[model samples]
Target chain A: MSESVNQQPVPLHEHGQRRPMKKRLWWIAISPSVWAIHFLACYITAAVWCEKIGEGNLRPLQISVGIYTAIALPVIIWVGYSSYRNFRRGDPPVPYDFDDPTDRTHFFGFTAFLLSSLSVVATLFTVLVFVLVGSCD
Target chain B: MNFVPSQSALDHAGVGAESIAGLFWVMLIGGCLIWLIVVGLAVYAIVVPGQHDQKRTRMLVIGGGAVFPTIVLTALLTYGLAMLPDLQRPAPEGSQVIEVAGVRWWWRIHYRMPDGNRVETANEIHLPVNEPVEFKLKSEDVIHAFWVPSLGGKVDMMPGRENRLKLHPTRVGVYRGVCAEYCGEAHTQMAFDVIVESREDYDEWLRQQASLAVAISDEAEAGRKIFAGSGCGACHSIRGTSADGVVGPDLTHFGSRRSIGASVLPNNADNLTRWIAETHRVKSGVEMPAFETLAEDELRALVRYLGELK
Candidate 1:
């Protein structure tokens, strides 16, 4: 079995870059990352505040959520706007051609834009949660 | 006669448990709808005969994948958040408070009387129906969790700090409670029974728990002598008698309880006999050693004595 496997020609896909280098793809991740960090900060703040100040007091948890929302919303909005601008700049001459540089770039930008939009909506939903829920039991 | 215990989240006997049940149904229905739609769309895309248009495909992906989940999740999140305060509502003005400390394999229970005296018991807790009862939980050893599936959710018992859970029983019945966290040996055998009764009945039971044991038979007296002579008093206690060991469960009213051996077995003659002879077979990690060296009649006498203390 080992001899036969070695003799077989390696698949062409194994020879080159598995995934293309697209630095701008990181843009799509910004909104979701903001949402995650904000969630962690909010949760830790609630737990520690409750432990220190007592579960009866809700002011600390409420204030922490307020601050988390205020800081997270603007950053996610900026990332979403940037992705939208890149997506709208132009379209490839012949769309859906991965071998063509311009087409690949266009595809990456559009995907980033789409993901950013979804993430922004998710971030907003999370902010609403922080605002609406106000207890630590 | 052994079967898996039914632990369903929908069976709510307390207000905390009721709110949890309501949340569960909402999530269940919503999740099923989402599952069906996603699967249906995928199936339709594969089976339907139609021209594939890029614009239509993009629109479908954006609408179904992004918009639908966002709307549904946002609504669920808001609803869940709105119920938080209700779930943690403060206990009623005169709610009774009880403290339960988790040990290696049992629960040390304490009821705070109005006269500032705390009545201590073990393994079993009795609560009055329709009354809010607050449980102040702690741990004497490693981390353990207190869970009565039919009554409410589980709460962790941390070693150094205190946590509180409030339960208001809506029904009169016996609920099985078990240690949800794995502390050490015999964790699976660390079970307790919560008896919910009417206020009058619960008060009478409480009064009985505060009193000493009553011995009325020669067999019991003979067994008591054996228990004292055999050094059982070093780790066991029968309040109102000479045996006052604090290392194990209090057996002052053990016979009257619904179950014995920390809910591992029903409190009956045969099971009690087997427990004294072969305790390891019944619960492997239990700290008690077998009394197989004792003669058959002596063991029977001891079992009868322990069985009739209630």
Candidate 2:
């Protein structure tokens, strides 16, 4: 099975050189736009919390809608295209070492922890601003 | 707005606000820092090649960080549960029981006093100051929320169900109450007032509400005929007459009541005219259909007759 497998390297992608390098560079530049999307996600989440606790106007549907459009979309494209680019570069495309089930579970748990932290820090900053500065009259 | 968090309500609110604000800040700060730490570990795990191989390193990251956080959450839950009883303190003797039914764009309030004499009104709720009162809440239609800031937390107003909340008024003031749910359009204007009065003032008011219907001019008799005839009796009820419509409040004492149109506006000749004519304009989402096209003379007579209910 090892002998039959195609190990020989191929071009990064069929259209690698066909498209202008500027466009590829532009896509690479556009990739960081995820941060803007994430910022919006964070801002909306904060708005939602304000509406819930501050005004009692927040609804679950509103939050879910905001997450998908403001948070999930940008993240999906960012991570997906980034991985694709690595494969296109022909540099050891797949790392089999990280495929262990335990590793995957750990990675997810680690991610959840970070997301929760973001929630905490964001809430703290919001409340501090309201308290110290008295944002609303 | 007698219900405005009285002195006791304010105290409840103050303490509640402090704890809420504290938890909010705690969640905010702690949550943010936790995110940073977890993200840092994840970034390291992903970028630092061969760092994934060391099981000890993995344990150090996951065990010390993620597992510990889970324990912290359990503790938070325990702490919250410990405070639940304080939220349900008992009402005092001779307390008022205000049954609040959340309706679209308004609130249907029924106050059943200790003597079994019941006073029902829409939108307007007046209570005595320094009294321990309980609210029996429900919704007539879709989901709604009962929320009065400067008092206590909120509870969902579910249909065909009842939820209760108790509060003690330590101050004499007016506070606003809002329907904190997204039931339909015009949700923004669905608001009410809690008018807390002094004990003596409340006793006098209750006595007035308990009296029989007031006398009206014989000329207003035409309006009474129209009220009973024009199918208004189908949706609204006048306790003294054959109008037993259950869709709306009992109008037996409408003429003597202090407010009108579910307390959206003061009960006056002109306001009553406008409400009867164009209720939807004043409150767009009001369940009652607009009667704006009614004739001028007929409107005057109808409003007068209704207002004569004492």
Candidate 3:
């Protein structure tokens, strides 16, 4: 029942039925946006601290915090910006699905299995953070 | 303030390991207790199987295994967090500070003796027994870890940044030190020794080392000429004479220091002669080239001269 990979549906007032405007915006607000803000704050604060105090002399705790924020910031920014752009432009992106354009279009319209797979990737990232935190003094 | 084990690293390392050992005992005993209880319950349930619904079997297992494990882990984690604050000791004050720098396959030591006098040595380190010693660790190129198992845990020696380790070895003994970090091919053979001596003997040793730079017998003096002319002086250093080169270990206290070839060979005349004559033979991955071209007599004389530096 999936369409070609390149198809992206524009935001419409009615899909199967009429929906409220506020409800539509709320539905469109993905979790990555929240992640972006969280990471941005963590990263900016740490980068400023590293710059001001010099990275060479960081104590173990500071080093752990700095490394985690530094790595998370760029990846979050890149993913959040790109996906948010595509969602707005009616050209939503799907990272892995090349053939089914229908698979690319969903905001909440994500594949249950694909979203489940994100849990594995997210878990791996969390594990890295765990190890980093463990190194803290 | 240096990175190497300026007494802090050594003491903390010991404390850290002891902490780990304590936690290990707790886990082993606690986990076994939980395991026995859970297994006992399971066996009791199986002895009278089907009293609960067969469909409930999976749920029971999940609850017993997964949920119980979560409880066990949380308890352990709580205990660990409670214990973590005491895991490592603070850096010691009123300690001897030694700066140890690691190169390709060797170590360079700069001992800042009391009275602000700096005695540069390599590979071999001497400390007054029972004194707390601190090491400021650095690496000239690749990453290296300063590890002396009996004294302390490993601390990485990173270039540009200083890492500190503190050690208070109570015994008057010679213990081996090794490069725990894998930099290259010669990493394993990269080793040294910590020589802990009586306070007065250590002082006497230092004075002899300081003077050996100038006072050599005639034959050793002649062999010293051979050392300089052979380009060995370019990598090695012998203070108070013309053998000043930054590429290798400081040889001013070569005879007095514990080991030769970084930590490779025993500090004796035969090893010194073999090391100088065919360095690669004794320590295969060592950075210094073999001086096999030297005449046998010249090599022996040079070894004897270096040995006398003590």
Candidate 4:
């Protein structure tokens, strides 16, 4: 059944299948993008608070950074989980089958997982900025 | 301003300097190591002609790229963050409070005492060794940075707002202070000398500055009259004389300063004469108008009078 499915000719006008293929690999970009967004959000909010609200009152800025970290971490973890699911689904019966598009999808999934792992670490680093650095003078 | 790190970060003048220097070294070493590892791996990948196992390659990427950076960055971030509060700690009790206002091309300093009285000085800042000094930094016109590299980090002086920085001078020596942020045309020549001396000497200097100028010679007296007639009082102020203008630097002890023209030139009769005659030639874009109308002798007398201000 798997060989027959692999042998089947892919349709030229089948836009639906191509979209899913691309969507499955979208996590590769989303993980790091989430990290960059979270970093900027935390930095900008802290700078605004430090300059405007006086450094003595840092609780509001601290809360905002905490919320940002909380949001970023979960999204990165979700990306990692999706990557893992896709990786398992795209596993070739014959390991290292580069000729097969399904097998190639597995490689992309693995790349997503690695990127998501790094993103999770980067998000934690951003959280560390709030934890370590003072919000104000 | 010169890009040279104000003084060697290795001097470890204060907590801020020490911590920053430590961080710099750590980053430098760690970065080099990381770069070498990455390059080595790339070289190995290029040179080695073999069919690599895909699963193993993925594992290697995860281990080397993600895991390595996370571990290293986590350690560095923790170490750096821990040093922040200590570097910004408030000055100790009995520490001196100096209000420094950053003008276009000079510094207006007010030494605030414990008794609520304030002593005003300009261009040069004198500090007592080993005493934690709190600088109340502000700007009259544009943003400026107060940086005495040997003491601590640079702090921005923003107009319409007050920022504070604490510096504890460990050594009794003169350090060059350059305005780290660019303000205007004369910013390059905008420099100040920070003299760190014993507490007794600093106190003595303040006391001397509080009084009027000492007795001027008959020759210097002629110069003072020329200064008065030239409408110098409209901009510059000499504490012991009738000249009291807030538009420019207070020349109360101008003669005693080591450098003039905002540390642009050595404080001497010739430099002062040239500075007064053509202010624009000495320091471009200065607020003080040139006094080219004054005769050569009159200019000399004015320079002589200012030299006796101490």
Identify the leading candidate in terms of lDDT. Answer: 4
lDDT by residue (B1-310, candidate 1, tens digit) is 1133334557667777787888888988888878887888899799988876879877877778777877887778788778776656657766788999998788888888888887777888999999989999999889999988777778999999899888888878777788999988799888898888899999999998877887648887788888888888888888888888977777887778767678888889899889888988998877778998988878877887888877
Candidate 4 wrongly placed segments (more than 4 Å) = A1-68, A91-115, B1-7, B47-60
Residue-by-residue lDDT tens digits, candidate 3, B1-310:
1223223232332344345556778999889978897888778787975567756766777667666766676677667666543332334666778899988888888877677877777777777866667789999999999877656557899999888776655556666678887889888878877676788988887677556475778878777777777887898788777788998887776766656777666678888888877777787777688888888888887777777665
Ranking by lDDT: 4, 1, 3, 2
The Cα local distance difference test for each model comes to 0.77, 0.61, 0.63, 0.80
Which regions of candidate 2 are displaced past 4 Å?
A1-137, B1-80, B92-94, B217-222, B253-260, B307-310
Looking at model 1, residue B270 earns an lDDT score of 91
TM-score top scorer: 1
Candidate 4 falls in which docking quality class? medium
Q: TM-score for each prediction? A: 0.86, 0.56, 0.63, 0.82
Candidate 2 chain A weakest lDDT stretch, 10 residues: A128-137
Q: Write the per-residue lDDT of candidate 4 for residues B48-70, one digit (tens) a residue.
A: 89977888877767667766766
lDDT of 4 by residue, A1-137 (tens): 26765564434213332322322545589999999999999889988887777778778888898898889889889978867765666336645346555665566677788789888877887787677776465
lDDT of 3 at B98: 86
TM-score of each candidate's B chain against the true B chain = 0.92, 0.72, 0.78, 0.93
